[model samples]
Target: MSAHEDVGELVPEGTFLRPDDSVRRFAGGTVLVGGSPLWLLKLGAQGARVFGRWVNGGEALRRNAGEQRLARRLLDAGLLHPESPRGRFTLADLTLVTPVKDNASGVHRLLEATDELSERIIVDDGSVEPLPEAALRHEKPLGPAAARNAGWQRVRTELIAFVDSDVVPETGWLDAILPLFSDPEVAAVAPRIRSRPGDAPLERYEQDRSALDLGSRPAPVRPMSRVSYVPGAALVVRRSALAELGGFDTRLRFGEDVDLVWRLAASGHTVRYAPESVVWHDPRAGLLEWMRQRFEYGTSAASLSARHPGLLCCAKVSRWSALSWGLLASGRPVTALATAAVTTALFPRALRGRGIPATEALRLAGVGHLGAGRILAEATRRTWWPPALVAALFGGRARAVTSAVLLPCLIESAGKGPSWALLRLLDDLSYGAGVWAGCLKERTIGPLRPQFTDDSLCRGSGRRLPASRSIGSKAGRTCDRSRSSQRYERVGAR
Candidate 1:
């Protein structure tokens, strides 16, 4: 399907959109500077006028097909976000499916929380005591993916909501999410998974940074994006889309949700993360349980990598960024500084016609390098920690470098105190150990691989924008009747 059709023919009227904070207007609002990986979009005069109208009104109005198309492009570019949808859907249109093993109390809590939903089905995956409320039962333990497939297969509603037994959704949780389904392209949407409140130190830590929590940002869920995947803990999906994909893969005992989401995107369907909808999930019973959960999560990397190749990459950095960092790490400070200077100088030359100032180009280069350092540090902690720890134990220099790499993690737990830092270290170690174990078991090192991208900039023009009303160019001439007038130039990282 075409990209336009994948996102929808037109963004529905009355959809509220807000420009991303990073978006900056230049050249009398004709040029836009922002998006994931960042880019420069040069709009035609008419397109700019339509954008200006949306910017001023804070809502998308269907004045013409051109305006709707422009709004859709900005949204797909990540430059604009839908603040809310004017349409509404009800719980009556949804069937709740819960997969459980032995958490009857959790089942009770979940049922109590979502009492409004009439069609609730529980899949009992071989619990010691069979649940009387179970609509489907397995004789032996099948993983969550299998159980969910079983439950959702029997669902007859237009929407199927797969909410884990452990979650208790907050009131009005559907208000922000149900409206999103108005876009037929949106296959699934997940809510923010927050840890249930508690005073224990572990509970406090989990509350602050739960693995399931995707933060407070609304984003189109895609691999390697700011928000990659959402947990299946609380997700509502269109019945037809899930059926089209044949539901979740039962082979993946863990990370099945990630696999399902990537498959949806691969199949040209949209998945989204809506943080405005909140669902409370109970944390692990204790520290060991928590560590085990983290370890299990890490183990899924190998299988996920096998399913979707480069998406599991530990880090992706530009050649210049990698060279500069490598030189610095190898004790060549002077050479590293020179490399950085050369990179900054070349950045502006590459984007010569984009109208960006030389100083701004230098700033972007610096920001890119800093961002690269953070990515490398995270990669070290997440995938290379085993080797990093071994190196740290032998030499003072190695220890120093490892300590520098670990500073980010410490800074993340700053106000939480030294004890929290220790937990953070343990967390990384446990997760990394699981990664190593999974790699050995699967005999694949794909997850450990780092992807390097070219630093050179490339620009192209085409009639790639969705078709609609003709937009007038800067020269006050209407576009060719056969093509679109929405011209854009990609400026920064790929």
Candidate 2:
């Protein structure tokens, strides 16, 4: 089926849609800016009118096919999201599959929390003490991916919920997530995994910024997007989709969840991150364990890069932004300012006919550069820190750049106190060390590569518009800018 047909099927009648937090309307609501890598959408007279109505909290009903098509287009572009899923399926259609190792106590705790769910299966991955409640057991300790595959293979339910033994689902967690299965194209949906509450300092940090938690925003799971991959600690998957894809890659002990999510997206299936459905996960017992866990996560980067090349990168930035930062790092502040000014000047020119005001264009360019700096700094700390540390030791321009990169992190944690900042530093170092180790073991530098792209405004105009012919028919033929603006005003006024 065509991409449009697929999206159309996914967004049926009665589906409530909301714009992404990144979405911003300009040019009297005729232009939209949002999506991963940022983008701009210029709407015609009728298109703007329809968009305004729906964006102002109206539903995309079947009666207005134009609005529905527009919603579909925006959704596919990642500009819109399903506000709340309304699925026909119930808990009876789901089978909860928990993969356990030697943590029988954890299994018991999880089972007690979810006792209401009758269809449950526990897969014992060669635990020293066999779990009496386990429906499937392995003689040898298979990795989590293999154990999950074993459990799901024996399940007859249409949907399978994979909750790790270490996780405990919040009450009524499925209420918000189960309905997402109403969309046949969605292969999986993950709940937000928050750290279990505790008074320890490390526990507090984990609660504030757990790596497993993908923030509170809802988003379609895709590589390079805000929520790139969901944790396997708790997620619901369609049995058919898993079977078609041959389940997770058992070869991978780490990053199997990321690999599976990426594969599902590549095969034209949707995976969603539903933060409204919360689940609690126990943080590693102590600081050492926490650091070890972060390191293991970093080690997966090389394997993930091997499986999906180009998707794993240290950083992605625009050429101009990179040049500006490079100039600043080299002590050419004046030159850096000039370069930034030039970039801001070009933004309006690139989007001259897109209905975005010159002021908004300039603001977007500035904001883009600021965001790029953050990305570069994060990359330096996470993947490039080893070389950065070496350069810092030499005490030159590299030292200055390294200090600049680390300053923001320290300042952000300042409010929390010295201990917090120290922990944050350790966190980055541990992860960066693991990344280097993984690269060495795999004999590939793919994970360390940086990606640079043309300015997003220059690329946004090329995005395909669904039912363009129909939209053109309703909006009338485009003319000069003056005429187009007048038409937009007329439609927007209504």
RMSD in order of candidates: 3.5, 4.8
At residue 469, what lDDT does model 1 achieve? 37
Q: Residues 1-494, candidate 1, lDDT per residue (tens digit)?
A: 22752335666667777777778886677778777656677676566776776777664566455566666667766778775555656788899999999999999989999998899999999999999989999989999999999999999888999999999999989888888887766889999999998888888887887899989877788887777888998999999999999999999999999999999989877787888899999999888988998899889999999999888888888777888888887779899999877876766666555556767767777888888889988888878988888898988877877888999988898889876787787787778778888889899998888888655541122111223433334322333243333445544453
- Each candidate's lDDT (Cα)? 0.79, 0.79
What value of lDDT does candidate 2 attain over all alpha carbons?
0.79
User: Candidate 2 has which clashing residue pairs, if any?
Assistant: none
The TM-scores of all predictions, comma-separated, are 0.92, 0.91
